[model samples]
Each structure stands twice: as C-alpha cells, then as structure tokens.
Target: MARKVGIYTRISRDDEGESLGVARQREDCERLADLRNWQAVKVYEDNDVSAFKRNVRREEFELMLTDLRAGLIDGIVAYDLDRLARKPQDLERLIEIYDDRPRLEFATVTNDVNLGTADGRTMARVMVAFANKSSHDTSRRLKRKHLELAQQGKASGGPAPYGWQKGDPEKVDQEAARHIKEAQKELLAGVRIGTIRTRWQEQGLGNPREGTKRMAHHRVTHILTNPRLVGYRTYHGEILYGEDGSPVMGDWETINTVEEWEAVCAVVAERQKSQPGRSLARTYLLSGIARCGLCKSKIRGQTNHKWQPGSKGARYKYQCSKVNGGCGKVARVGEPVDELIAQLALEEQRDRAASADVSPERRWPREQELNDLNTDIAQLIEAEKNKSISVSTLLQVLPEKERQRDELKLDRARFYKEQKQAEAKDDAVDLSLEEFFDLPIERQREIVLHSLSAVFIHPSGRGKRVFDPDLIEPVWRE
Candidate 1:
C-alpha cells in the first residue's frame, strides 16, 4: 500500500498577489509524492512566515505536526530541510515525532529518507544543524549592514518618524514639525508633559504611529527628548560619538538645534529626580514651592488616613519635611491654608493689573520669520544634496539660522508668559476665592508660583493647631 504524505510549503515574505515561490515549492513536493506512488494527503502552508523566527506562530505548521502524530500522514514532504524549519530545536521536534512511528517516512524534492534507519536520522540532524548555522550567519550580516547604514547617516528600515516620510527625512511635514518645536519650548518653560499631552490630544494633534488624536504622554516626551531631532544618530539608546567625543552627524534632516535638545533633556531629568512618586499627579498645589519658616526646609504635602467620627477617609495637610526632627509645624486644615494662599495670589495679581498692560500682542511677524527660517534651512540642505553647495556651507549657514530661530522662540515664549499673566489678572477679578481653587491643580500651582517667590509657615507656639495669619509670610514676586 502507498504511504500517505503531507506536502508542506512556506515563504518568509509573500507580497500581495505575489506568492509564486511557495506555490512552486508545493507543486514540486506533490510531484515527488506522485512519482513515489504515495498518496498526497493534504497541503499545509505557512505564508509570509519565517522559519527562523521562533516566536512567530505558524498555524499550518502546528496542524501538520498534529496530523502526523495522529497517524493521518506517514511523512511530510517539502522542497528542502530548511523549508521544514530553520531552527535546530524545531527540527528536533519533527525528528522525535518520526521516531515515535517506525513506519513513518520523510522526503524532500531532492532526497528521500527513512526514519526507521539510523543513517537517515543522522543525515536529517546534520541538515538541520547546517540550516541553523545559516540562519545565524544571515542575522549577523543584516545587523552589520544596519550599523553601516546608520554610520552613513541613513534611516535604517522602519516607519519614518513624525514630521518625516519614509526614505526622505530631508523633507519634513510642516504641520507636524511645528508641534515638535512647540513641545520643546513648552517643556523648557515649565509646562508639565501631561498638560502638554492633554492639550495636544484635545487639539487633535497626533503622529502617524498613534493616529490623528489621543496620543500617550510618553510619546510626546519621546519626540521632545529624541537625539535624532538634533541630527545625531543613536545606537541602543547611546548617541554614537566620533573619536573626538562629539556626536556623529546623521544623514537625516535636523529638527531642534543641538543646544535646545540638550536643554530639554536636562530639564526633564532634573524634574524626574526632584519629584518622587506621582510626580505628574499634581495632587498638591504648593508641595514643592512652600517652605518651613522655622527650619528653612521644604514643606511637603502629607496625608493622614485614620478614620474618626465625622472625618473623611483621607485628610491632607502641609507639614515640615525635615529629616532630622521636624519643628512640629503643621497646617491642621489644608483647605483654609490653601484658600489663604489663593487669596494672597489674587490680591497680588490685582495690584499688578493696575500698572502693567501685560497684554502683549501675538508676534505674528516673528512666527512668519520662523517659518521663513525653516524654508531657508531646507533650501540649504537641498542645495548640498544636489552638489550645488558644499557640506561646509550647510554646516556654516544652518547654525546661524538656527540661532536666530531660537532667539525668536525665546521672544515668543515671553509673549506667552505676559499673555497668561494678563489672563490671570482677569480671572482673579471675575472668579470668587473658592472658584479659583476649582481650577485645574496645575493652573492653580502655576498662578501661585508665578505670584509668590516663597510661602513660609512658622510655628505659633505649643498646642496652637490654628493657622495664624501673622505666622504665614508670603514673599511676592517682584
């Protein structure tokens, strides 16, 4: 009786409507079964699958193994041993299945094998070992090529980043590019990343990878912190440096100036270290800004969780956070002390509103100039690419243009600050003292820190839990 054989075929990458390679492999295996007078039971195929990828699921491959163990097929016929599996461990599994059935047969388009014989099993093992070695060699070569391309300042194969299109990093998307620049300025100006992220998501700003809206906060931070924005290449999270210790310039177009990128990174690192758990939570308005008048130590927010009659589950307060014995200074009620600070901030704003206009007009001309500067830089890079100008000309003129742009950015930031101050002055007059606390905690913190340089609470002797107005001194900003 003829043995039942299963024909298996696979292709690593099968482009749409282009799977002739795997089709041909299947045809060859079926023809071999016909010549040997064996019944071709079924065909199992794993399209667009790599045998070398251990984690990638090959459903048909698994099904074939299942059928083989059920005695549904006497053997598997493929174009080659490598097509069966490129990993030695995977091949060992097939060998083990064949060993369980002494009558099982295995064949390739080029060779026939008997699992019942020792020589056939030994040759099968040797073939799999060679296939595994070939897989490793191919991986090593690809990695070496990737590093070489990176050294040459080219984008190694992946989806292009925001503000850029695949294989053309020189031409940037203006709308997306503007967002990147804005994020850098915001981070440097003390706007929290979560705030920026929320605003961007609300404004319908998003990258290609994350869609047209609702991006994660870390994605926003990633764009701001990327070394690639400054025209440098990074390998495994470390910037690739030249022998002189300067960053190696990449072939891709630059976004922020190198100085601006470094400054953003420094600010982010500093904030991360200073703010402990729940850094971005913004639960306390004055946690990092207030100080203990007695010990001159930072007053941090504390929560007491003891449940008493008519008491809330968690009671919040501001206490002296001295490591070596606190001066026993604490604000028993957070609401009253917070209210007092809010009232003081509003009073200062009312006074400032009397003198300064604080309503600086938006510098549209400066913004236009910034847009023009980007055009000029792009033109310079294009000229260099076309061999119309030397790279020396690019390296020279680009920095000056970048410097001008950075200066204009600083001016724009100042205008924004003045604008916010003017708006706060209006809010102070319109909203009641209680309504001011109802604002987002971030906005409340911004207004308080903007108006006051320091808020110090002194101890008012023993058994005095009451917040004495005379003991609290706020140093208003000049």
Candidate 2:
C-alpha cells in the first residue's frame, strides 16, 4: 500500500501571467511524490488568487479539509508554506493541524528541511509573516501608482469609468465629455440633482452598461461633483501622512482653473446641504459600534442637561469629544437612535435565520473515501522511513505530501468554523420589520445594537441613515 498523499498549489494574480504556470507546479509535486513512493491522492489548485485573502475565498481548499478529517489522506504536500497561506494568522492555523493531530504531518518542499526541530518551525513562521507583509505593501504601492496616473490625467486602471474606452491614447472620452457638459449646464441652471439623473437615464446618456440602462442617483451625483469633468483633478480623500505621525491634507494639483470647476463644486455643496432624512439610519439598532463615524475616534457617553427641569431625566448620548471641542462634530444621542435601529435589526435577524437551514450530511465528506486516502498516505510515509530514502528522494516526494496535508487541514478548519457559526445562529428570534416597530423602544434598541454593524448618519437633520445589513441579514445554513 502507498501513502495517501495530497498536493496543493496556488498562484497569485501577479504570478498567473509569469513563468509560474499551474502545470509546472503540478509537475514538480508529482516528481517528488514518485521519488517518495507516495500515492498521489489529489491535487488542489487555486489560481490567480492572493494567499493574503485565502481564508475568505478558497472553497476548494475547504473541501480538502473534510477529506482530511475523515482520514482521506495521512499527509499534505505543498510547493512552499506561502503557497498554502501568506498571512501569519492563517499559517498558524496550518501549524495547529499538525500540533493537534498525531497521525498528521505537514511538509513543504522548500521550507521543511527538518519538521522535528523547533528552530525550523520558527523560521517557517517568520517567512510567512514576511510574505504577508510583502503582500500588503504591494497593494499600497499599486494604489500609489494609480493615484499618480490619475494626477497625470491618465486612465486610472479599471474599466474607464463610464465615459472612457480602452486603447484611446489621448484619453479623450468624447461621450463622457458630452454628458459632463450637459450635467454642468443643468447644475448651473439650478435644476434638481435627482431630476438631472433621471433625465440622463431617459436620454441614455452616460450609462456605463447597456440594456434598459438608467443612471444611478449616486452616479449622477458623482458626475456633477467631479472636478475632473472640467479638466481639473481632485484626489478625493487621498491619504497623506503628516510630519508628526498624523494624517493631514496634502498638495493639490491645478488640473483646471478654479473658476472652470466652480459649477461642479456649487452643485455638490448644495446637494450636501439638502439631502433627505434617511429611514435606514433610524432602523439600525447599533448606530455606533466601535468609534464615532464623524471624529473617527471612540465614542463616549456623558450625562448632559442633568441640572435642567425635565432634561435632567434624559439618558446620556454617544458623541465624539474631539468634534465637540471644534476638532470634530457634535455628539448624537444614543437612546432614541438606538431604539429605532433595534426595530430594524430584529427584522433582518428573522430573515437571516430563515435562510440558514442546511442538511448536515451534505456538508461532510464520505467516511469510506476518507479512510481509504488515509490508509494510502500512511503506507507511503512508512515506505520512505523504511527505505531510508536519500535526501534528493525526500525533497522530491515531500512537497506533494505537504500539499495534501495542508489542503485537508484547511478543509477541516473551515468545516468546524462554519459549523460553529451555524450553531450560533438564533432562529427563535422573530424579527420582521413590522414586528420590530411594535417592540418597546428599549428592547428595539437592544436588538439593533446587538445585530447591526454600523450606521452611517448624514449631517443634515433631514438626511437618511445607512444601516449595516449584516446585523439583520438571516444566515442561510446549507
């Protein structure tokens, strides 16, 4: 009997077009498996995906774990540890599988020179951390490059933003230019912003996609507010670091005369001052979760108007002191706002529970398949040790075994995580929006804050609030 082994390979988006073809990875793993006399159980491949965000997206990798836990494979092989995961958190999880399971082992072609040594494990972890940081740094560098291109009036990468097409050297989007002029004229005439958006859609102007197209209100607002339309560029919310380790506004480039872009700014300012009150804001139970949205700082509760006649009985509100002291904005009362939010949250909770039911049997792997694969991998490892395989032979075979082990471990972790989450879902809670509205204000507030993530409130007294849907959205257990 041969050792039941699994192989895993991953190629990031940057590696996809380069020399790191999936076939090359498979070939390397296969040649190694042959030398170790291990049976190739399966090969798990995730292509054009980033390892940094692997935990969130890799479903195939999760399935491999189910196979592993059921004893489908004895070990996993991978080209390298980073190929399994770039993030330290996720790498630590891989280490946990070996630490927790006595029958299991993890091997990497490049890094597992000695699995029995503490120093080897430490080196592997350090390498993973470096890889994770590199991925993050690369993302930041890419964003900077885009900003630089935008400043130079070049296309800022993705899908040409409604008015432009690819391969136009001059970057002159004639169609977008026409729409911008029309929108500018409407703004100058003091036409209602929403009406302008409707008109654009009716006339099939500036629709990014085809077929019964309608311009979104937000899209219209963005176009009317863009200084770029007037040949002037404004880097909205550009991140800049100040000298004292604080962030501040940086340099502005004069892409067009201020006078030329005056109409666009005026329209934006007017719209900002007159937006409608948001019902969604009132609906979310938890308006402030971690920090004050306005001040970007933690919110604190303090009693106010305590000495006043009836006002003394009022509860404390959540506000940002930084804003209240002229550094930020006014504090918002948490009680009524939280009450309204709770009502909305309950409705979402009910819906989520209704969607979360799934058959448990379908979620796990077949017992027989798992046992067979485990048996095969065990045999392979036994043969390697008995033959006292040469260093060259071990190097060739180890990676495939490591990949298989890692894949199974990932699958098992995902299964357990999902099971835990599913079990945690509250199905008994009846949370319809109407039902929520009927609940007492305090109960409503309790549900909202507990269920909702965040609520974005508009500055205007009449402005609407945006709710974080996760709190109320029902979990669909499948």
TM-score of each: 0.49, 0.36
* 145 Cα displacement, candidate 2 (Å): 4.4
Report the Cα lDDT for candidate 1: 0.74
Candidate 2 differs from the real structure by a C-alpha RMSD in angstroms, to one decimal, of 28.7
Off by over 4 Å in 2: 14-23, 53-70, 109-119, 136-150, 155-478
| Winning model by lDDT | 1
lDDT of 1 by residue, 1-23 (tens): 89998999998876443678889
The deviation in Å at residue 443 for candidate 2 is: 42
Worst 10 residues of 1 by lDDT: 416-425
lDDT values of the candidates? 0.74, 0.56
TM-score of 1: 0.49
- Candidate 1 RMSD to the real structure: 10.5
* Clash totals for all candidate models: 1, 55
